[model samples]
Target: MEQEKMNLKLDMDVQKLETKKLRKGKHKAEEDLKSLKTDYKKLRLSMRTVGLGKTLEQWCQEIQEEKIKVGRWERKFQAAQMQNRSLENSLSESQNERDELKARVAELEKTVHQYRNRNSVVELKASFGRIEQMKRTVEELEMALQNCEAKIEYLEANDDHQSEQLHYFQDQVTKRDHIMGEAVV
Candidate 1:
């Protein structure tokens, strides 16, 4: 009877651990889904700016250009994120490492907060010079994203306009041909 009770207790402990892991997995999956949705929204919006009337080749070229531009910024963003993670992990490992990491984290956190909480461009300019650099980089990325979108829209709009013009000219040519045929007959 004593052994049976111990076995049941162990089984319950195993079940609890499994449940905890399952819950963690579910949470991570949800986070990934949300991140993917944001990325998809940005991607679809960027692609839609490209127009239908453009030749397949031109559309392809535009897509490649967009990809290159986005890829560069993404690499920079990813590198920053990775560095932050490494700092975090090092902080978690030992007392000495933790103190050094904590100080680094504190400095960065202060800088980020200062930049984020600034109410005016003037205040930001006076407070954090690196903040200006970060803002400039962000603005450049936003402009690149916008320009790529505009290029796609221009291609599509021009294609539609040209298509309508082509159809009109085609009708006129057909009408002239028919008239010539009738007159000749």
Candidate 2:
């Protein structure tokens, strides 16, 4: 009985050790499986990122589409360049026309200024002529006024002489009348 008990205890200890080893091996296998799953996810993400997930035909098709888009954009860019050149040319023409117009306006203004100066000269000359004519008229009027004054002075002197002659004649007539009356008496 004692030998049998020893054998049984040893067998139990051996079973415990084998259970512990199996548990450890199962935990390590689970960790390896988790690591493998994470590596598989990273590999798939890398494949997509590197464009390796698509087939060669799909890549070729996408490249062809991109080339078509590039061609279209190039055409549009060329057309825009042509339009820009046309606009630049038009702007240059407009600027030239504006410069010509400005020159014409300046010329017109200069002509107007010249005409105004001529008109001013003519007006000044006319004014001088009018002033000269007025001066002559004033001189003639002064001469006529002097002559009229002289005539008035002569007429006044003649009137005074006539009044004195009349007074002397009347006095002589009265003396004759008085002598006639004395003779008659």
lDDT of each: 0.63, 0.64
Cα lDDT for residue 81, candidate 2: 58
Clashing pairs in 2: none
User: Among all windows of ten consecutive residues in candidate 1, which has the lowest summed lDDT?
Assistant: 89-98
Per-residue C-alpha lDDT of model 1 across residues 1-185, encoded as one tens digit per residue: 99999999999999999999999999999999999999998876665543233568975886687568556655654655565455444434444443554555567557667776765567556546654555555455555555555654565565566556656755865686566445644
Highest TM-score, which number? 2
lDDT of 2 by residue, 1-185 (tens): 99999999999999999999999999999999999999999998777655466678976986687568556655655655565565555555555655565565556556556656788777556555655565555455555555555554554555455455545655765676456445534
- Say what the RMSD of model 2 is: 55.5
**Clash pairs detected, candidate 1:** 49-152, 49-153, 50-152, 51-156
The C-alpha stretches of model 2 lying farther than 4 A from their native spots are 1-45, 48-51, 119-185
